[model samples]
Target: MAVELQKKGNFYMGEAPGMMEMGISNKNLDDDGRAKRTGTLITASAHIITAVIGSGVLSLAWAIAQLGWVAGPSVLIAFSGITYFTSTLLADCYRSPDPVTGKRNYTYMDVVRAHLGGIKIQLCGLAQYVNLVGITIGYTITASISMAAVKRSNCFHTHGHHTKCNVADYPFIIIFASIQIVLSQIPNFHKLSWLSILAAVMSFAYSSIGLGLSVAKVAEGSGDVRTSLTGVLVGVDVTGTEKVWKTFQAIGDIAFAYAYSTVLIEIQDTLKSSPPENKVMKKASFIGVSTTTLFYVLCGCVGYAAFGNNAPGNFLTGFGFYEPFWLIDFANVCIAIHLIGAYQVFCQPVYGFVEKWCNHRWPENGFISTEYAINIPAYGAYNINFFRVVWRTVYVIVTAVVAMIFPFFNDFLGLLGAASFWPLTVYFPIEMYIAQAKIPRFSFTWTWLKILSWACLVVSIVAAAGSVQGLATDVKAYKPFKTQGHE
Candidate 1:
């Protein structure tokens, strides 16, 4: 297998045709392939930053306000520790084989699905897809808010052209979909990587500028909202019951907001342009994941610090658009490009699964044959990578529509993702790895891993619970500004 998928004792469980071809599929993948795709230090570095940064980078101020400064970084550090241990364990399990067959390359569902089984797999798959789609929504929503904030910041609030117009939000969805559709058509990952790096760097610089300005203004007592800003910074000094209550709630909120580590899975395969079949256990497990840890810690802590209490609703857009609306729009347009790439890459698995089903139904249609049923106009039946084209379309449409209605709130999505990530990214991977290691471990090493896994399980519970609590409490509080003619 190229990435990770179902495998019987013999090894091959399934082939993710779409994802496998582009060399990013999680199934039908092996270590050697990953090792081959592994790029220079720069590419690897950018992958980590882009994967972890996402929507969370822009929403740091509001998140930190809920959690306070000291606790925010503390949670990030804790998440890194857990994420490393869990991600490594999962990667190692990927290396481990089926015990009965003694074969290695434990595919994604192949090894662990037995432990959890059919219903669980389907449920997890659904959850994973929702998380994926919802993530887009969260990002899109944050982007929309950032668009508004940036506009108002530059005094575009009164502009006639870019005025607060609410054409059906579906248009945003369709536009983003079109962007992804275009990108998915290109059968390359390297160019995309370069683009990702550019986006990551530009976003980092833009956010830093905004954060610096926000902090400076706050310090000078010219904060956007002086009283609210002070309240967030100093917090309540009152003691006794109220203080204890606030402290615990604050700590919980901080923890929930900061607890995100599984994003590694979401982006790593996208960045791995090499043949995943060749990579050894150590490189993929410890090396890749640990490297990822450093990036996340740096981006998260530095990002939160930079933005302070009034960071932009979208991290990349910063708190506001001090730049001209045209320039900002241009940036969003580029971002739309990036998002399309991401959406298609993400849509790979679902596309692959569908291909598998269709191939089975009509053996007459070869995996890559256009004889099946779908076609692209002028492009012809086989014009584009059929699977990739369809998948991107499906994802872009679904995600865009969802974003239009639901809006992607970064902190909220981050927290929810952390919660659901428990089983897939954390618990299952460690257990599967330990089981594969097979060394009887009452000893320190064995005991520690078991302990770590258990602790991660507990933390996942906490994160999920806290996330729900925060969402229930705060979700309804936000209201979109009225668009033109809506009032």
Candidate 2:
């Protein structure tokens, strides 16, 4: 890769340090790595929780409810299975490079850069941006859904006002987004992890209430446990709609689970902090992926059960269900807060990129102060608001018209993400190991990664297909008054 280092340390896309080498390894890494800044495990766990529990999670019940009680459980098993394989393969890829560099370490960019070269290296960034930004958009929309749901029940009054929908909720979405954007630029954010914990706890409360209500409702009408057993014995599959993309949605869901590549670089950097041992890296992956899988399954089950019937939008209508508006109001507050944490982690790179650019591009004359500032300005950006207006306007035009011809948002989009990520996260790293092996054959692993890589490729394709299919078949929209589980 060609890097034109200007008088200042500024470099552009063409010559960014992201290019070259099998990975980005700074040999002079400190004894402590990137994670040295990390605090307690609760904080760490909180970070992971918020990052993974993105907007797609709102679809858990909405999607699972379509397949019935049985299908709800199926999603859990499927995601767990896919995540195990994907994570194991990814960990194995990292393990291959024995005596790996510390701190400044290899990244996803290097996997492609090593094998496919510069053009492909550039594409990796493109993939990262697409997956992450699309994810951001999806989060914003989900936040809107959550916000609108909360607002809805507050005004659910008067027989004549029943038809008056909450179209005015759009402004709230912009406001919620404004909150996220402002939080993104903050530094010294270890305390913000609590926001994720708050959301998770709120989600837990929501699931508990919904589950209790569904069970009580089922028991009251079914005439005892025997009837419940019988109901379980005769589960139905509503995913049998004529839509071809339903299968794709399932695939995409599976793919989305594997989108763990989003933080692969971070993981590697974390491992680099510890001793050069594969065990720690492998342990972290196993713990993270396994825990995440189980957590998803349990949460998905509770949500699906709460709905009992397949409906659309979110699994549970936060606002319209059960009693006081207090529950939903709290849920909205938690979602908004949790997303605040999520945006901060993801936006770091964007801010870092720009800062590095400005630092390097501008000459080290009397006009600059670069005392190793990490975080950019977090709040009070009048110019940014103006920029957002123009930006959103353009985004609407492009996304609605030109982007329509391309695959923008759908069930298959997740699958597309999974498919691209399969290579970036699972296969490529292991394949790189095989390519660079010192001894052509090493015990059983050399042969294993080879087989595993192909298997990973297969699963990615299948999961992506399933994600697309699931998305197409799973067409439940968020309505305030619908009962009978999500379908």
Candidate 3:
């Protein structure tokens, strides 16, 4: 009797398994069987910038205020390095073999579920949804504030600051959310490349304008310049518990400022794997980080020098929307445009998660398949469906409502950073890398990395606590829902 059996390791009867294998998926191809490769190095870099830089940059001066000159820039640089390292780890984990086929995990949850397990997947999904939704709310708040600032500036020339300025965030939130609702229909992250570039340019525009204004203020001796080795310590500082709490809060803020890791895998999925996948991603990461770091350092130090401890959470607010008013208006416009795009970029993953669940639960419902591609001019072909409209609209509405209710712009930033930044940015990447790299638990490198991970956990805990304290304090001190009609 002749018995034939397939070898355990052999994926094929006699052919050796190659290093990489192709599999069909929505991400891998368009409708016409053409391989989908959308983002280039430039566009990838643009996505990175649009993802990394947001309302968080506006909070850097306030972050510097928390840590003072000595620790402020130091923490920003350190987090940048840390985030870059973790992001590379995520990039590495993007591709993995599934017994006979290789697959690219498109979302953060996919990575966790693949390496970790279902429990971690659920937790990651929770953290990511909260992080993304909370972040959108924060952006909404910031956009409204920017609009309000411009309006106030425009109005102040006619009606003074003292003249009962009741122009609230409600109107601006509705208008901006309307724009976002329309833009959210783009369907794919890679398709938003031009928008990402536009957002990046806008980010630079506002940042440059802010930096130039700040430098002019300092040069002319028109603004306060407080520079010292220990500027924060020198003053009558918040001693005891409050000081320690604020320090933790500052770490959280810095973490939030550097966090694009949560969406790194999704963004990497947008790039073509032709130029070696990790290489393209790393280059894009380096470009985006370097540019944003430069902006953060300049804006933080200059804004700090100009306003010292008095620097508002948004440095633009510190500028008070005064002369060169056109620049301020333009900067705010840039911010508004950038946030609209940023909202879509970040929310794409969230939508995917929801849609995936819905499709699995109600596979027979025929909610319009997203499997095939429709060709578009600039963004190539994309899979658009009716579900995109319904789900994303609901998502936008929810975020808009939260923004209207909380409207605690800066406070919410600290809260989100503290709560989500560690798990998504620090903890997940380090753990996943150790698992993927097969690093021994007690090995010298593993021991050190584990220690660093633990340290991050501690920081995250303290930061969360401190952020909660700060939020509560703000709530008691200041009223939420600034709009009277909303209340």
Pick the TM-score winner.
3
Q: What is the TM-score of each candidate against the true structure?
A: 0.67, 0.67, 0.86
RMSD of each: 7.6, 8.0, 8.1
- Model 1, position 448: C-alpha lDDT score: 83
Which one wins on lDDT? 3
Q: Weakest 10 consecutive residues, lDDT, candidate 1?
A: 5-14
Q: Which ten residues in a row have the lowest lDDT in candidate 3?
A: 10-19
Report the lDDT tens digits of candidate 1 across residue range 1-487. Answer: 1122221121011232343444666654444433234444455445444444455544445444445556555655676566556655554443336432233332344445644456766765665555555555565554454444434434543555455444333445555556655665544333356665765565455445444545444454533442222214444433354333333333333333322233333333343433342233324344444553444345444444544454443544542434445555555544444444344334444444455455566544433333232356675443333554565567666766666655535435545555455666666666666566765769777788778767656665655554555455444663543321100
* Per-residue lDDT of candidate 2, residues 293-387 (tens digit): 65556555555454444333354443324444565556555665555556555544443343444546653532321222123366332212222
lDDT of 3: 0.73
* Model 2 ranges off by over 4 Å: 1-36, 39-41, 66-75, 88-103, 110-119, 157-164, 187-244, 267-284, 306-313, 318-324, 354-421, 433-487
Candidate 2 lDDT at 39 equals 35
Could you tell me how far off, in angstroms, the CA of residue 464 lies in candidate 1 after the best superposition?
3.5
Residue 295 in candidate 3, Cα distance off native in Å: 0.7
| lDDT score at residue 286, model 2, on the 0-100 scale | 57
Superposed on all Cα atoms, model 3 deviates from the true structure by an RMSD in Å of 8.1
Output the better candidate (2/3) by TM-score. Answer: 3
Which is superior by TM-score, 1 or 3?
Answer: 3
Error of 1 at 375 (Å): 15
Each model's lDDT comes to 0.47, 0.47, 0.73
Q: Using lDDT, rank the candidates from best to worst.
A: 3, 2, 1
